[model samples]
Target: MADSAESAAVPIISTSTSTSIANVAASPAEDEAIPVQRKSSSPVTDPGTSPGQAAPINSAHEQSEQEDSDDDSALGAGSILSETTSLADEITQYRYEHNRRYHAYKDGEYWGPNDDKQNNQLDIAHHLYLLTLEGRLHLAPIGDNPQNVLDVGTGTGIWAIDFADQYPSAQVIGFDLSPIQPMWVAPNVRFEINDACDPDWGYKKNSFDFIHVRAMYGSVADWPAFYRQALAHLAPGGWFQQIEMSVVPTSDDGTVTEGSIFDMWGKISLEAGDKFGKDLRIHEQIKGYLDDAGFEEVVEKVYKWPIGPWDEDIHMKQIGLWNQLHWEEGIEGWSLALLTRVLGWSYTEVQAYLGKMRTGIRDRKVHAYHIINVVYGRKPIPS
Candidate 1:
């Protein structure tokens, strides 16, 4: 992993609007922009009427409304692009191997991509998480207005920002390896660069009211040790929740063939993660880890996340669409380092394999879904 101090101090670099396409939410009439490097566009200049000419009231009102709408639309896209640029700036000084641009941080450290594609995928996955959780930020029983919260592995810092917005009384800190969080965040929400696996988290003992971690599968080298550290830092009665997606896809109708590309992807991903001392399938063992770490009132909620718009339920179908898009957009970024660097496959071979896997992911007939596991536990109060 990158040095946490250096990552935090890096300046935010400027990026063009072209990179903002993946961040924007559009109406039916709007067009989606493709993700590509390009020069920043000039600001939209106002076409003011001539000095002597008075604009019509109706046209003026319409223009004002249009401008407001434009600003609103641009805010989300701007934040997303800004966060990506900041993260890129932080890690650009690091050594990257191969034409694939994979970071060579600690040997056998995080193998995930930190570029635009991965950032966009993080945003999309956040959307899907909201949808799956029925618009709830988390399933933890964090209680109302918890004073202090920490989001471990807070990619893109979207959850931390939203949580801060939801509970203004609480201070939310998003900790991550890369400085991928936006510069413009809520007063209560801030991003820090740190490794969760670091035994000495540098926080006061029993300080945090709540701690949240999500989509961190295959990131940490030690699961039990990490939970123990969380337990140590959490206040008595504080809550710790972990959310992870099972990398292995399952099918309800048995349409996903046993030896298909989906299975192959999961197998290869698991092997790669194991090689790095992090297992992508670690979600399966979270409950055990929490139990072993002496957490109390442990609870687990599992949700099936369909890969395509194949679900019979309307809500599930919409979720599947988002998941499908996220999977498709992320396949390349997710596979490149794992396949080429760790798994000893050529870049071309990895791309070819991902292409096949993506086809399976998009096939609605497959009815494929991954299990999303959410487990939370509380620190017992001292007797």
Candidate 2:
């Protein structure tokens, strides 16, 4: 088993662009399998707007719906309009690779699955994120209200919609590479199918008071450029918060073994991300990137998210259960493409490998947990 210290040293891609492309510095065995970061061959496509507007899914009556019920249904399924709304604005046709689906616009741009299963997993993960943070949508000190806000790579538009509801006066825009977000939303909130990698962003310069990016690790091709765009668009004194999960799981008590399947999954996934031009293991470098981007007062908070119901604290135990489900439900969707398409493994091989990874995830004795980093900084105010 590759231990945490050994795994942290391996570079997942060529370091031509940035030295921070390494996943973990694992032992020679792991390092030999993965190398430094390099540019991905897959081209990013323009994320188009939905075909047309539809009614928002969370209607007034739906407000009475319990949080538990919300957690049960897929992100957009609870709405009466889900059936029509999802298909209404078909900006790009669905494309498939290795029996799994990918967005057609930028064929191989996003390596993650976008089908119903993946969508539900994203929503469930959102629930877990909220639970872990004690229901605070963001840690940025935006105060009572802000006029303009942006949510980059807003999957299913859950966070944006919730933010809009929390601050009725603020206008929130949710941007993503897929048209998966529902058509209708809070009047102040709107969903746009667009790519964050584009250079000529349509927004006015320094117009947004807040920008929120969550779990967009595998999609962004250039971290420096992404932060530059955030800095450019943010209003003076505006806040930018990036929330991400580490691909590598850690054990504080030295329980998770080295060379574990979970570690291999992280290695292979990070390598796949390199092949596709995005690095999955860049969470640790976000703070420096923000600082280099000229942001001020940067702050980073890391949380230990357990993999199973193993923690003694009731809250942590519950978070672990949800986190476990989050991984269990999406494991295949997350691994199928990278393992088969990029790594050139047979489907059977991929499944066999995942079975082992799932076992590691479920074993409470492993004491396995991934770190969630929430880093936020303010766009420096003019002197």
Candidate 3:
């Protein structure tokens, strides 16, 4: 990874751009691998909408149905399609025939098995290496001479690199679905391209002092199995941290406007998950899974992030901006995966419906906001 690249699509970090991009500074390793911010290739593509208005998935009955089921289960029989080596080989064949398409791999564009991101968004998001720095969130209690950390779903390999730099004696490993991680990492920091969800991946049990996962909202259909695997593999006194979002649905004063924007968002996003066997409600049930897996000292911190630059406070305002960008980009990103690909909807139709969603978010009468929640736990010292 380079320190920077010419600004490409969605350069949120550029001063020339209208928005601010969150960047974290680490060590020399970071300058090369973790903190390198760059532009993404390929402009956001427009997915089309339904030519005729169809009955949207009914939310009234869906809510009742959602209340009765537990989304957690052990990994059952499944194919290894998600972790296939050559995305172009299988994914291209599948998408060309099935209308499935992934964003071009230029900078940090890997979703499942594609390697792209030369940028370092993943590193800054973790911010775990900044524990010693003033005012940054880092999971501690690694003991005085801690070493050996593992980051699951390490998007850009930033977290692992920074952690290795912070603990010079520690060996850090980061794993993801693609080979996008930079080839040159810290001497102690290594990157592996593998699906963490795979049950048979070769790894010694009870290793690693810390394990981290973030933003796995819909990508993980079975979180319980995911958590169970973490518990089973975690060494004594190991820690696991998970961060997720509320999927952009909230009620201000508990009175939703008629035809509120977020109502449309909730319908589309959740229904998209429904069609794909993904779980948007995974955030709500994390605590249950952690406790059931026999983990101790479980902690859950939920933050109600503003939707846009609405709040009077400046920090809250920026968070609102991040929220807005996340919402807009998220719709485009997921549509490429779910609606256009899995749902087999036309690109034009998805674009038009998304425009309606954007309109809803801009409407103040809608009175909606969303939140990001984080949950973490530690394995007790073995008896």
lDDT (10s digit) by residue, model 2, range 1-383:
12233221122322212112122122222112122222111222222443232323232223345436756477564564774556544446777766777775556667788777788788777776666555677878999978888899887777887787778667788877787776655466777767788874567678789999999888787889989989998989999999899888777778866777766767778788888678887788899999999999898877777787677665566667777877887889877877777778899998888889888887878888888888899998888
lDDT of 2 at 207: 77
> What is the model-wide C-alpha lDDT for candidate 3?
0.55
* TM-score of decoy 2: 0.76
Q: How many backbone clashes are present in model 2?
A: 25
lDDT of each: 0.71, 0.72, 0.55
TM-score of each: 0.76, 0.76, 0.67
Question: After aligning candidate 1 to the native by TM-score, how far in Å is the CA of 237 from where it should be?
Answer: 0.4
lDDT of 1 by residue, 48-139 (tens): 42243222112223456566986667567678699868865655455455543443334346777766678888888877776766567777
Q: Which candidate is the best by lDDT?
A: 2
lDDT, candidate 2, at 111: 73
Residue pair clashes in candidate 3: 47-347, 47-351, 48-347, 48-348, 48-349, 48-350, 49-348, 49-349, 49-350, 108-117
